[model samples]
Target: MKKMNIKKILVGTAAGAVMLGSMAIPVLAAKPANDVLVKNWFVYNRSSDFAKLWDDNKATVLDNGGVGFTFNNVGATTWYTAYLKAHYNGDLTGKTITANVSVTEDNATFVTRGDGSTSTVGIVIKSAEGNWGVNDYWWPTNRQLLSALGTDVDIIASTSDSNRANWINICGLPATDATIHSGPDCVGGTYPAESPYDGFTNALKNVKEVGLSFGGSGYARGVALTGGTASFQLNSFTVAE
Candidate 1:
């Protein structure tokens, strides 16, 4: 696959939520009209050279104003990441971030390796503690999250196999007890202590950006991307106060 360079452009803030394809991002003067502040994002796949796939056509805005992307030959170790900076200048310590995410497979099938383990997807939020530096906290699948939380959640049974759109909520951030509050339809959990940004309280206070990634590691290699294709979409991303 061809490696693409991801670009970032800071635009002015508009009156309403900025869709993926509409006008450029408006400046963040004050709090947004809605409870959740949304920003334009750029999505890319991890390249062989450990780079982000920059083909603009692969990641595009849908007619409904949502963001979408197509993945091909996504290796077991391969993963996709969507980068979006926070346009809200206010403190997100007590705020909650939520999104409606969906993934569909088109002629796509995973290449089973050892144990026929499947892949999972989830979100991550990073803070700007070191002056826009990296302090990221990952929220993997529910089973994974529960396991990290010292729960008896079954990892193998935690694979997200459906193509349904589910709302995921990451709440109580910037707090020591921050948690992933997604419903049964969705699978997610808070950042584990092993994460670089495990300090959720500190990280949430200075959140600068958020990421969405797919694939699994550890027991097996990862999600193998052989021949089929997968499309991912984020219907909405909101930060509630």
Candidate 2:
């Protein structure tokens, strides 16, 4: 009976240890279901005030090439910018992503400064920035989109200028949303009527997220005062998932 009692006590202790260990394992290894997932779109439209600065640079960037404009006093200068707010379901810290930006302008103009007399002479994505600038004329000084994503503007093609008839496609992951601006006014003096692309799209390849900036600056590029005059429009934007 004494031996049987000792054996029974040992068995009970072993069972208790096993049960405790099982409970602790789950507590230590379990993770919440909402730990990883991102969902949110940061979109900016031409209508948004972000495009205001483009109006100033219209002269040098766009109109400088001898484009036409509705606002005569609008020198050949225009400035344009964009912003996006994406809701990463999870933490976006240390994630690699690629964004494809498409821009179109209507009734726009262009002035070829460098490489004088080039077919497609117009504003290029100087760099992507996180925040909006004071006006389209001023370049974004903080949190540059290119510096963040570690890439530069990759211009696939550009069609038309100084009118609503130009198309631009670029690929890269800006550290954050992109603020694209262009104008022809490096020589000072204010220009007005900076128009943005009719539509804009932002895509994150790593997480598979896409956002459309339609109503505000819409997902469109802006027009400058370069020359030429016509209603600028952006075609539907497409991105590979």
Candidate 3:
């Protein structure tokens, strides 16, 4: 509900990639590691606030030593992988993705990035503009990620130092193309949905910028303190064959 005083803004690219500044990002010819998925990223709070970044409080590290994300309600974060640029716009057709999310009882009631409050975990695929597959959970009711989900069960939540809300990615994208979103309106179906190759299918094939969304409905920061500070973390995210 609260907005942040952002200093930096993410610059969109023709390839649907996002850089820290408005400048163009150079092309990369790197490849994935043996045991890891990605090594580079375009990490930022959805708010693009640099207040936290001015200091040494950067985001956490991914499993393969890549960049991950961290933020509060006023500084919710998103980590868009640069694998597309590095690999000439790669496609995640048959690969499986796995990751862990850290949630707190204080954030159980807070809905995640989506429309109106129909928050869910979004695994977006894009190129200039694209679609996403989601796991739309009923806030305060859905306990798939965190036990909180507005239910306040706090059964299997996560913390700053730990991540328990794991995800296997099971959701669907919109019927059209998009880069930014308020949130999802429909229930989750299947990620990287197969078919017509005009919506989700298209985005997955020409993947330019894939987003790992875990912020509040409108980039609300913090994940604890009952929404005082929207601190959240995603860890060990990996895509493998």
Q: Over 4 Å off in model 1, which ranges?
A: 1-39, 49-58, 74-90, 110-117, 129-135, 140-198, 218-224
Which runs of model 2 end up more than 4 angstroms from their true locations? 1-73, 76-108, 112-223
Could you arrange the candidates by TM-score from highest to lowest? 1, 3, 2
Q: Of the pair 1 and 2, which is ahead by TM-score?
A: 1
Per-residue error at 195 for model 2, in Å?
A: 34
Q: Give the TM-score of candidate 3.
A: 0.39
What is candidate 3's lDDT per residue for 161-226, written digit by digit as tens? Answer: 122122212232223333333443333333333322234334445555443443334222212212
Question: lDDT tens digits, residues 114-185, model 1?
Answer: 334455545555554343322243343332321121111111111121311121213223222333333331
> Against the correct fold, how does model 2 do in TM-score?
0.22
Candidate 1's error at 61, in angstroms?
Answer: 1.2
Instruction: Assess candidate 1 and give its TM-score to the true structure.
Output: 0.48
lDDT of each prediction vs. the true structure? 0.38, 0.22, 0.31
RMSD of each: 14.5, 25.0, 15.7
Q: Which candidate order results from sorting by lDDT in descending order? A: 1, 3, 2
Q: 1-241, model 2: which lDDT tens digit per residue?
A: 3331110000000001111111110011212122211112222323223334322212110111111112121233323223232333221122222232222223444322222121121122221244322222111111112111211122222211222223222322122323344454323432223223321221111222222211112122422235433221111111211
